[model samples]
Target chain A: MNSVYEGAIQDLIDELGQLPGVGPKSAQRIAFHIMEAETEDVERLRAALAAVKTRVKHCETCGNLAEGEQCSICLDPRRDQSTICVIEQAPDVQAIERTHAYRGLYHVLGGAIDPIRGIGPEQLRIRQLLARLQNSEVKEIVIATDPNIEGEATATYLARMLETMNIPTSRLALGLPVGGDLEYADEITLSRAFEGRRIM
Target chain B: MNSVYEGAIQDLIDELGQLPGVGPKSAQRIAFHIMEAETEDVERLRAALAAVKTRVKHCETCGNLAEGEQCSICLDPRRDQSTICVIEQAPDVQAIERTHAYRGLYHVLGGAIDPIRGIGPEQLRIRQLLARLQNSEVKEIVIATDPNIEGEATATYLARMLETMNIPTSRLALGLPVGGDLEYADEITLSRAFEGRRIM
Candidate 1:
């Protein structure tokens, strides 16, 4: 295996191992799979990789990922401008869209506030979000951050900031899942953390 | 996000999803990870993907993956010439080498004789193996096929074929694993199974 191709395979494995959950074993498996893949398929991935760096850009107003000056949601007239759902990333916007529950625009914050990772409010698109809130036509802002600790802290910080700006803000409700068990709930969970609780 | 990299992420995700064990979620994760990766790292993977096809070749004698005209094992003089251990694939050769117990030469058959898959003995490198046996210096031939239905049938066929050539052959011992429980043994097991057998 100590051949000219060994270095290339090792390099691929190293690159693949950098992924969030991919370990050395998984990286090796993925590298081998890629090696066995068709040339056209590999070219597609290569083209996509190059294209991401060259084509994708942040929307000027809502901070959502867009191919042009603004995201599709911001440009669409059918979407409600009065209600903007704020999220941590572009993928979150896609997740919400998949449900078809919110017929409103979205604001991607890029990431949640994580003191440990040195991610501050200023580093996010919080200022742009505030600018959007300045419009009197925008009646409500929905904080749809993740239910995790960092997400909660960011949401709380944003909510406090919005309150100072005289903007009515709301967060995504959380409690037991639709078919969850109370016994499995942690201490902070069963307390009905969200103010509004509906009996099923 | 369609800023500059319009459908690049989607295209990469689709390509990654085509892998054997990777799903859509994993593919998305991988695509994002690759996006965040450095250009050099991505280029390394691309180079490696191409190198495997250009550099690697099948060994003329054993049919195992090789870097040159023949595999390293086939060229090494320290390995015993009189004994050849037959395996199913190149990876199998690596697995055996990891044990450090076998110092003999090897013969990779490419794949097992699977009738359902239309692979017969003629399709494999069995002819090359017989040619190697014709040399009078060869003494023992070890059948190290996997312990499965197809493997068993292939080994039995090879054994019957070798018996006609007046050569002493042997099969790897099979039984309970070290520190394994008897209760977990299946039907084929716990019967004709060895009790505290010693390796020769």
Candidate 2:
């Protein structure tokens, strides 16, 4: 709103509103707070915005983000080199890590194949991933993309691509979430839960 | 969560999380977006943040945010000087303006008298507002603070202080919102609605 706000404050609000998930009202509130904030505090935030862009880069080998050429996981010696987790984005890497269940190197695809958005296999990091697998002794690849239509499509394509390569590939199982009520489960999820049922 | 993020990126997340409504998860997401944003876009945001801090300041007369010594409202000769609307904060001015109503001068209190948070009248612009009232032809004052405890307290205090000045005072009426459903109305609101019933 034009209101009586100065040009500088309005410009700040416009800039903040461009951030994902921050709408117009939130941007205005944030601009006012930043204006009233301590000089050192705003400076710290400014430095961070500048530093992240300058310091962070994609890990050349795996397509995940990194400060240098290789991500921390790729540089770590203890992670399993024989198995690699394939994820859609760098943030997905963080989500999987929080589970503390995986201890292998990761390959970030940057995004999944979605023809609706004009994104296809060639647009992703699939070529780089194939290159990583060619000379490596990796025996297994875990496709950890979301269970949506696009994610499944990507996983199926990758599985087919690796069939001749002889490296076994698997997808994350679809099931009812733990601690969730069966009544609240959607139809497709219920069917998937049945399909994935075990003898126990 | 730090996960595999570099130090600078993590610092950025922390700084962003300190903003009013942003949590750690949102902060992380925003930081990543900032890192991936175009250099020109990020520079514009940075400049806006810096300029707001350097150029925006409080209006000397009304305590509202201003680029110059006095706010636009104060400088506008068309505004009615006989009627002054007292509000809790500068943003309140915008809210009132958006209503397309009220064309009088405004006095910003900076904040209400919040004792638990250690804020008092002395912390506000009460003295300046009082000085503006002196030897002026102002006929009425509208105490448009919030309807919450602190706002009501401030309004009551201001009304009592202005009683000797013989100028009429008023508050924003509390009632059911225009499009709100009466079925889902809370008790306090329902009572307010009943109390504020108007004759046809």
Candidate 3:
């Protein structure tokens, strides 16, 4: 946290350090960058920072980030509202969209269940998801959460709860990635790939 | 410059990308961090960013960054004003201070003579430095610029100018570092060390 700068320069470093993924050294480096940047450029950055808070809002239906009542995905009429691909965060929605494969809607769970982090379904948008599925024509719920331990746990919990509602639940496949060398694969990944082997 | 967020989020990413050292993916990551950060934290960061430009100013005497007429080092009475250590940038001032070995004052050239970048002696604080040395009680001038080619060129240029004024000039040594392994030392560094070998 210690830096050579004082007053405003030091203050900038402190504030930048509070950001996620930014360490003390990175904060100092970035603060210097801001110090040397042109006035117009810095002003633009400040405006963008402030505008994000005022203009961006969470989607009322799927808990995804949006500029209005709904995100771009939720607002699109061409998307299949009957099938919702559930994900853990907004970034996951972006990743799926980049593939240009799925034409369905999305439901952001806000976060996965992490007992260590004290994050549970109660703290997430699970209630909103259940409420959305109540009176809807939704036939399938695609759980596209990350393939990590926490994601798997959340997927299982949601699948069990969704079983009583008679809605078909599907989890993303857990296996070897495309073009991955078998020799370099981890034990658990290799085992999962063996179990989930497809008939070609 | 691609981000998962649309509207305000994408705008935030674009703005953040303008900062030095931050790439497209880093901009997206930082934008997401700002999105998730608490309102108070983001507000504080904004204020700090704005405060830096408004509050910080270049020191009148040495061209170093200062909150007032002079930098803290220049204002201090304990420093040796008779000997001025000339350096390339403000960060060099911090680096020299960390050593606690030299008690002399500093003269920041702002930048070295980089012909490729069109930065020359005329673009630096060389005029101000000469003026300070003219009617003042400065005895020896230590050219403590970096050991790079540009730094050497700047030092030689300053040396030529100061030669007519009869002020003693010196430079930081170029050789093997204290804790560096001999096996990893480059040829140029080894040859320099050989030339500057100390008598046992």
Candidate 4:
């Protein structure tokens, strides 16, 4: 509790507790760790925080995190310009990039379509994605949103919007994970795996 | 992972990962959360970090965390100065204070003696504790070190040193935790529980 610590220590603990997933005990541990850490290390962390706020910006074209007007993926000429993968956050782009299987451009939706939270199609970057499609020589649209309810809703909404445009669109396949055991798969995933089964 | 993010974002993730219990995935998640957070929130965290480093100082007498020359416990006249509870770190002092059962003074040794880690009595604040004993009207010493090997070793060493001083010295009892199941209690704890059973 704040009462247990002095002014600065309590303040640090309170601030650290505000971060996602960091509870009060964890915040206390972290605060003490920082207090014991080298001055240079604390300065580096502070500098990084300041730099992220000042230096990083969103790509005007795709809404992905970037250093300049466009992100590294959007700026690179080697990435496939004919295909654009749409997804819910900048981190999703990073996750897809880790696989190295896809070399296409990405459109970050900023967030998903959640009716309860009042996040609709307009809250996302759907308009920018459509604008990119209209001017560019893009051939295929890949909906790479998450497989959850909100992501599925967003993907369905995007699919309906693109139906009249005549461009071939696809969604990421849903099935049992690569390394997961069959017995451990949930009912939804088991059904999806069965439906998407193919002959070798 | 650093390759996936821009300069500042990657740096923030790397710094966050250095904290105790935070893995790479958690670091990334926190970094993104910070990126999306309001500017004022980020500034508050930074300010707290800076303030903690600049303001927090160890108590001159007991080595507990303090704002000035002495900690609040050391400065409080209502607390019993006749008894001193000697513990490992400042956090341990906080843990003991939370119970409200002990109303005496505290001496923080900074850490217990671990010979394997090259941390001996010299590394801790044992000398300062002895110095406090020379002038103070302290009648008893309560060793509240952790129950691990290092803590036990430190307590034994202190007891041997204090044996010649004609002062009463004791240790905190060790037994099964209050809410722990008897079947799940470890062998040493169960043995300690049996050894510590009172007549009542």
Number of the top-ranking candidate, with TM-score as the measure: 4
The model with the greater lDDT, 1 or 4, is 4
> Model 4 misses residue A53 by how many Å?
1.0
List ranges where model 4 is wrong by over 4 Å. none
**For model 3, how does the per-residue alpha-carbon lDDT over B34-74 read when each residue is reduced to its tens digit?**
88788888899999999997888889998777999898888
TM-score of each: 0.86, 0.97, 0.94, 0.98
Q: 2 or 3: which has the higher lDDT?
A: 2
Q: Which candidate should be chosen as best, given DockQ against the real structure?
A: 4
lDDT of 2 by residue, B23-131 (tens): 8888989988998899899989989989999999999988888899998888999998899999998889898988869999899998999999999989988899889
**Native contacts kept (model 3):** 0.68
Summarize candidate 2's per-residue lDDT along A1-200 as a digit string, tens digits: 66357699989988998998898888989988998999889988898899888898989999777889998899999999999999998989888888889999999998999999999999999999999987799989999988999999999999999998889998889999999999999999999999999997
Error of 3 at B120 (Å): 1.9
The order by descending lDDT is 4, 2, 3, 1
Task: Locate the minimum summed-lDDT window of 10 residues in model 4 chain B.
Answer: B1-10
Candidate 3 has an lDDT of 0.87
Q: How many residue pairs clash (N, CA or C atoms closer than 3 angstroms) in each of the candidate models, in the order given? A: 10, 0, 0, 0
Question: What i-RMS does every model get?
Answer: 4.1, 1.3, 1.5, 1.2
Query: iRMSD (Å) of candidate 4?
Result: 1.2
Report the number of the highest-lDDT candidate. Answer: 4
